[model samples]
Structure formats: C-alpha cells, structure tokens
Target: MFFRALLLLLILLCSNCENQKGETSPILQGLLALDYLILSDPDRSSVYFSTTRSASVEIAYEDGAEPNTGNFAVAPTTSVWSVTESNLINAFADRGYTVNVTVPTDLSSMSEFPDQGRSTWTINQLLALVPKYKAEDSNFQSAKFFVVFVKGSLAENSGVIAVTVSGAFGIGAPTVFVFKEIINHFQDNLSPDKVRKAEQMTVTHELGHALGLVNTGIPLSSDHQDTAHGNHCTNTSCGMYWALGDDRVDSFSPGTNPLIFGSECITDIRDYTP
Candidate 1:
C-alpha cells in the first residue's frame, strides 16, 4: 500500500487543529486531516442538512470562467461548477453530516491577463493567491474550507489532475485547487454535461477526503479501504475510488444520472456521526 504510516507523517501535521468537543471529530481526526498530494487536488480530487454539522465549505470560482490561453478554450462557467457545488452539499446532507456549502454568485475574474497565474502552482503559491483573491471579496474569511477554481493547469508535469492542502499542519487557510485544463481534456471527447459530471465528481470526491472517509479522518465501518490505492474505495465505480483515471470516473458515463455516494462509504460516515 502507498499509504504508509511514515507517509502519513509526511502528509499531515495538524498542530493547530482543535476538537470542539474535547475530542477530535471523526472527520477531523481521521479523514479530513490527511495531507497527501494527489495528481488532481481533491479531483485528483459537499453539504446539506442540519445546523449541527461542524464544517462548512465555500467554493470560489474565477470570475467569468477564464478561458485558457492554450488550446483549451470554452471554459466551464460558474454554473458548471455550481452543479458540483450542489452535488457536494447533497452528498453530505444525505449522510446527516450537516455540512453547508457555498459557491460565489459573483465569481472573481482576471481579464487583465487571461493566464492569471502559472500553469503549475505550488500549495504555498495558491495559498498566497487565495487571500489576495479574498481581498477583492472579503467573504473568504468566513469559509471553513475554501476551494478555488482557476483557469490554469497544475501538476501537468506529474499527471496530477489537481491539488489541495486542507488539514495540513501550520496552514491557516483550508483549501482545495481545481484547474480548468482538466475540463479541456474532456471537452474534446465527452458531451458538455458529461464533462460537467467529471468536474462535479472531482469536487465531491476531494471533499469526501476532507470529510474523513476510508480511514483518513473518520473510522471505517468495514474493511472497504483499497489500501493498494491509499484512502480510496475498493470499488472503482464508486465516487470515493482511491486512484482516479481520465477514462474511468463513473459519474462521467452517460445515464449514470443522479450521481450518488457508494453504499459502503455512506456506512462509514454513518458510523462516525451515529
């Protein structure tokens, strides 16, 4: 298994995390707190229901859905990501986790330079960018988990689809990164809705990691973890599948309508809050 105890040491350092109830919440202790790097942040990398849910998510999309300077034009709009935003909220809501999710109605934009930032960005670099973005709109200070959708590529060199540094130690902002370049890769072959499905699935999957599934933040209900693939589900078709591939994401398949959580994963979350 790639998920070694020593690797855990390298991925997560939650020094600033505190248990609101004197003990770490299941999500905080096991799942959400993991700090490993993926090809796509949380895509490579939800909300709903109940006020008691401790963590909330806010999704920030670049204003106007900037088209890449590269060949991948026709960026997915904020509405595209909003489909993901709603999907995420309902994913948690069904589990009774009480997570609240928000996406910007007035997304931030960068018309000055269509290529707003580098093709590849490091966590620290993205960190610096988030607050600067918030400076344009201070609402960021309120979100517990902030995901930024920018019109660029990340980990293009590593085959990583995206990146997130949420729950890492010494970090003040808990965040996730999504790149538009990924959308471009699919736009050529998949229908617009299918492409959007891939985008939404990535959003919810990463948030699942942040919510503590498959022994990351919350304890497991069964032995469903694909240890071979780190913290992903054993079922490749499942949303929480550990290793993601360009061609294999189940949500992208036509008629896979009403993207839903896998049964075993929901059992795990239920065990945590029940």
Candidate 2:
C-alpha cells in the first residue's frame, strides 16, 4: 500500500519530467529520495516489516567467552545464543521475514586489554573486528546484526552488561557486545539457568536497540520514550526497560510467552514505513 502508492506517484512524475533529463530532473530526485528512505536506517529497513529482504544474525565470542555449558550437549543449549537466536527467529517470523542465525564461533586475538576485569574494548577496537570477521566469514559482513559475546566491558560504559553500537555510525550493521564476565559476576554464577536467563535478558534488550526501538532509529507511534534513560521504554515491565533485573527473566521465558516489547514498542515496529 503506502509504498506502492508512493512508487506509482514517482513513476507518474517521472513520465511528466521525461523532457527534462539529467541530474536536475524530477525523476532522479525522486529516485534519490526513495533510496534515502530505504537506506537511511539500514537495520530498521531490513529488520522491521521488510518483505523483500531477509535478515541474518551473526554470533561470535571471544576465546574465553564461549557461550556454552557442559550441562547441555545440544551445542548452544543453556547458552546466550540459544535464547537470543530463538527470540529473533520468532520475532522475524511473526513479521513474515526469514532470519538466519549463525552458530557461535570464536573471535580470537581481538582483545586489547590484558585481563577480564580491566578489559574494556574501545569503539575503535570493536570497529577493527568488523574487517577481520568479514574476511574470515563470507556471510558475516552482510548480516543485519552482529553479536559478540566477550569477557569484558565496553570502554564507554563499563557498568553495563551489554552495549549496542549503531550501524548508522559507519559500523555497517548494528553490533552488540555481551559482557559475559560481567553478567556472570552480576548473577553471582549461582546456577546455569539463572546465568543463562540473565544473559538472555541482556541480549534481548540490546537487540531491541539494534532494531531501532524507543524512538531511536525507528519512528514511534506514540510518546512512550523515557526521557530520563535514552532509547528505553517507560514501562518497567517491558524488556526494553533501562535496567533489566532477575525478575524480568524469571517471569518471561524465551520461546514460551515473552512479552519483551510493550505495546508502545510493538506499535512503533508495526507502524513503521521505510
């Protein structure tokens, strides 16, 4: 609908501007506008309500930050990847898009800091991994989202369990870094289920940032953005809340009945155009 109508209008305008050719013509201008409309927000363009393009999710972990436990032999079972992958697949499937999630692989030698406690990856260090991944894996460079499970914290925000870097800042697709050690420390490593659930909540919350939630990149249907915390919903029960707690994870299990995004966030996602 709306897109089709816009396309038809552009085509009709092109016909009228046939006599005036070259870059100054209305046709070129209209086409350029269309291109910007589609490409301006790359993540949202591919992830939200996109019928033509499918989405790919790449998972990688540092050498010491492998996302697996001995409790489950099903590879990523009882791991962060298991929960996040299934959540993304189900979310995209609901919107009529196929999502391809790669298995967790090792990202070696990219650690700039010495140890886990003081290891903080700067933006430049994170950007450096982009080319290395693109060189090794063919599908990595083109993925809509890149998730790296690491053992340290973000250079900018050390207290956060995870952080999302926007592709709009020239990183290509949005990249998410889950601080495995921090999550483990925060959860006190009590049990596999508790740690995994905490990790799942963190990853899902960060992925919401990648998808342009809370009026960041994606347009909002209503005024639900939390003015206090940037790019987070005001609803405390929502997964996109500023800070996630054990209660959130305990209440909502992945793949069963996860009300991750509240009504406002869902409205923004479904009502978005280009």
Candidate 3:
C-alpha cells in the first residue's frame, strides 16, 4: 500500500512539474508577442492582449462596409486589394494558426489618422478597405486579419510596417498622392500603357511591408545572395525588393506574384508568429 501511494505521489509530482514547466516556458508566449507585430501594428490600434498564451490570431476590420467618400471613386480594376487580403489569409491558414476578422463600428472614425502628418487613410476609410469574408468558418473568426481602406492614401506607418504608394511613378502604392509635376510627367511623358501594371505591383510591394519583409538597405555580397535574394533576399522573389521599379514591364513577375511571398519569407513569418 505504501509503495502504491508513493507511486501516486510520483505521478502527481510529475504532472505538476510539467504544468509548471509549461507555465514558465517562453517559447509559446514569446511566439505570441512576435505574432502580434507580424499580424499588424498592435501599437497603433487598440486591440487587447490576453495574459494566457495560445496559438490563435484575431482580425477586426476598422470600417468594412462603409461607402466611399473620397473625391474620386476607386477604379473597378483596383479591387484586387480584397483578393490580396484573401490570399494572405489563405496563406496564413495553411500554416496551422487560427485567424479572425471583425468590424467594430465604434472604432470606425476618420480621426484615427493624425492631421499634422502626411494625409493618409482615416480609421473609417481603412476599415472600409478591409475585405469581408462571407464564407462561414469558425477558424477564421479566431485568426488574425487586417483592415484596409478603399479611398485613402496608401501611406501607412503602423509601428513596424510602413506602406507608401507612389502615384506619379505609377508603380508603388497606387493611392499615394504625388507632386503635381510628377503626375503631369506620367500623364504626358510616360507611356500610358504601363500605368495599370505599375499600380498592381505597387500594392503587392506595400503588402510586403504588412508581412514584415523590409529592406535593410545593406549591400549584398555573393555569400548572402542565396539566403537574401542578393540584397533583397527573403524568399519567393517578394515584392519587397527595391530594385523593382514602375517603369519596367518585366519587373513584375507573374510566376512570383506579388501576393504570394517567397519561401524564406514564409519562414520569417512562421518565426514571427506567436
């Protein structure tokens, strides 16, 4: 009987030790904090964090269903942003994390953007840009999703992710406002044929920022090329590379679609996810 009692005690102690170890280990919790930044700029928004650690992500659109209120309507062809968001969600979902998208009406106001700095999307507009997920899935409700704006400048400086669209260059962020001189040059001097392609590539590039594949501005040596895309290395010929300009038609690789990140980029994301 004494031996059996001791055995029970040993089992309980082992279980308790495991629980304690789990409580103290940083791997799961550490991953969560990293994921918070990877998903979006939690610092800029007012989302709450939990004390307990878990492998789930939640996304809320700032103003998903509002009407467009800008000077001009968004072109029909520009609706690819929603497609891009869908692709992003699918890509993340394939990796075993849960993501959720919400549209909190109370958080839907234009004042979210500061007045003093460069004009950008109001919180309301940003919310509107976020795509709506119609398909019913419980997992999506628990995963990390992002908000987007349909009619505002593409410039977003949310904590670590900053996106700027160069409208004049016709290549980077499509919604960015450029100098009148640049706009005139593109309209008159540059080939009008390239505008559409440039706009698409620009959105993909900006999305790269959203995914945390940033340019470190360091020159690439031969040794670094395999790992870093020369200087722009991350994986999958990501749009984050600075060498891709608006003027060149071949700069946009259909095989390496801007929406899909390279393999190395995926590893970085997985590492960043909590």
Q: Could you arrange the candidates by TM-score from highest to lowest?
A: 2, 1, 3
How well does candidate 3 match the true structure in TM-score terms?
0.36
TM-score of each: 0.60, 0.68, 0.36
What tens-digit string does per-residue lDDT give for candidate 1 at 16-131? 35523476555445544454332112211112122234334555556544422211113333354444455555555665334556644323432222345566666666677676
Q: When superposed on Cα atoms, how far off is each prediction in RMSD? A: 10.2, 6.7, 14.3
Q: lDDT score, residue 26, model 3?
A: 49
Winning model by lDDT: 2
- CA lDDT, candidate 2, residue 43: 48
Candidate 1's TM-score reads 0.60
Clashing pairs in 2: none
User: Which structure is stronger by lDDT: 1 or 2?
Assistant: 2
Please tell me which model should have the higher TM-score, number 1 or number 2. Answer: 2
Among these predicted structures, which one has the highest TM-score? 2
Q: What is the lDDT of residue 70 in candidate 2?
A: 31
Least accurate 10 contiguous residues by lDDT in model 3: 44-53
lDDT of 2 by residue, 168-227 (tens): 332256678778888887744446666766776787788878777777667778888898
